[model samples]
Target: MTETLRKKYRWDRIGLVLGGLAIFSFGLAAWVAPEEEQVGSVLEHPNNAELPESIPALRVQEIQTEKAKEPELDEVVLPCSCNRNVLKLAKNPYSDHRRAARNLPNSFFVKDSNELNAGKRNGKLVEVKDGRGFHISALSHSHAVLLPEVKALLEDLGNDFADLLVGTPSEGTRIRVTSLTRTVKQQNRLGRRNYNAIDEASTHSYGASFDIAFTDRPDNAADCSAPTRAIQQVLSQYQKSKRILVIPELSCMHVTLRP
Candidate 1:
């Protein structure tokens, strides 16, 4: 009887152990099955359903563009022989001669009447005398051959009037000439012959070459008016004819056969 009771007790313990194991196994399956389903859903759908529909997806793109700008060029202007101020003086006939004269230095000398007549008659020597007096000391003679042509042109301009005056600097004006003459000889000796120096062979070496200056009249108001007008007219005519070249800065006129 003791042995049989012992065997029955062993069977009862085994049965109880099996029942506890079954309950534990059921709890594990319930927890693990839900988690496995959630993992599968995450793998299938990367975007979460909880995210707002209004939120847009991010985008990237490249754009080409150009900046606005002003035009580089508008119009081209033609070069002219006469400038604006020269045109203005040409139009204003009664401009002030004293003002113009005052602008000139004291060194300027006029060609004398006698020399002027001789140049016109002989058509050879290019000499200009002092405007203050008809003295030979104030005269300058050039060796350029074109002196005759320059003189002829000046004569044509009718600059030989009693009132009109021709003047030159005591030294000389800066200009270019393309001739061989005695004037170039003296200038070369004095080291005054620069690249721009008028060649003795140049037309400017002729006494016919001239620069204008105001008459030394006490009454600046009266004498300057008519003479300035007349001079301007003559200059304008010469410019139009291309007989004389005027450099405004030097206030000197260069006359020649060449343009």
Candidate 2:
């Protein structure tokens, strides 16, 4: 009976020690555990790893779509002044009106029709033939002739002049060549009608000068004035480019090749 009582006493002591240890372990776990609010929020809202990947792809597609909708602009190439100046080097010098109109050498004068024919045959002169861009005045056609270089210059000018007048109200307008080559005799006859004619030492005799009336129909005010300013603008471009020297005369614009 005494031995049994001692064993029971020892078991009671062991049980007390085990209960104390269990209480200490519960306190430590409670101190280290995360807050319920934080743990519950994390569980409710999972991280979306795929969201970042989709965002960049959507942004790239939006940028590409905007680029495709934008208008394509045409590339405009500007003309180089150096290249144009090089072309102007082919122009003549004495053609400028600033030079003294003194006794020009006999070689410079078209003394008669025979000399004019010689010039034409030798390719020194090009007869001004009426065609698409221009029409020679009836009085001038018979004697219309110019230096080959001058003729080419006029042809190019005429083409550009026509292009400028195109799409305007007076689109089909043609430039008029009122005077071209003039001999001493033709000059004498023209002098009777035109007070501005330079009877002696005229550049016309040299086959390097011509006159352009602003319009073919001088009598029609609607036709003459509409394109006059525009035509002058085109001529001014040529003058500035050094291709020709222009004299804005009362009746017409006198143009001469640069010597």
Q: Estimate each model's TM-score.
A: 0.33, 0.54
List model 1 lDDT by residue over 100-209, tens digit each. 32222221122344543454466454433332211111224433332545434544544332234434221111112222222434445524533324333322233323
Per-residue error for 32 in candidate 1, Å, reads: 99
For 1-259, candidate 2 gives per-residue lDDT tens digits of: 8899989988988888888888878876785475566676666555455668878989999988877666432222121111121122232344344242222222256757998888888876678887555668776533888777778878887787678767666555567778887777777767766644544656677776787754553223244454555566667788888667766555666677664
Give the distance in Å from residue 124's predicted Cα in candidate 2 to where it truly belongs. 1.0
lDDT of 2: 0.63
How many residue pairs collide in each prediction? 14, 5
Candidate 1 has an lDDT of 0.38
lDDT score of residue 174 within candidate 2: 65
Best by lDDT: 2
Deviation (Å) of 259 in candidate 2: 2.8
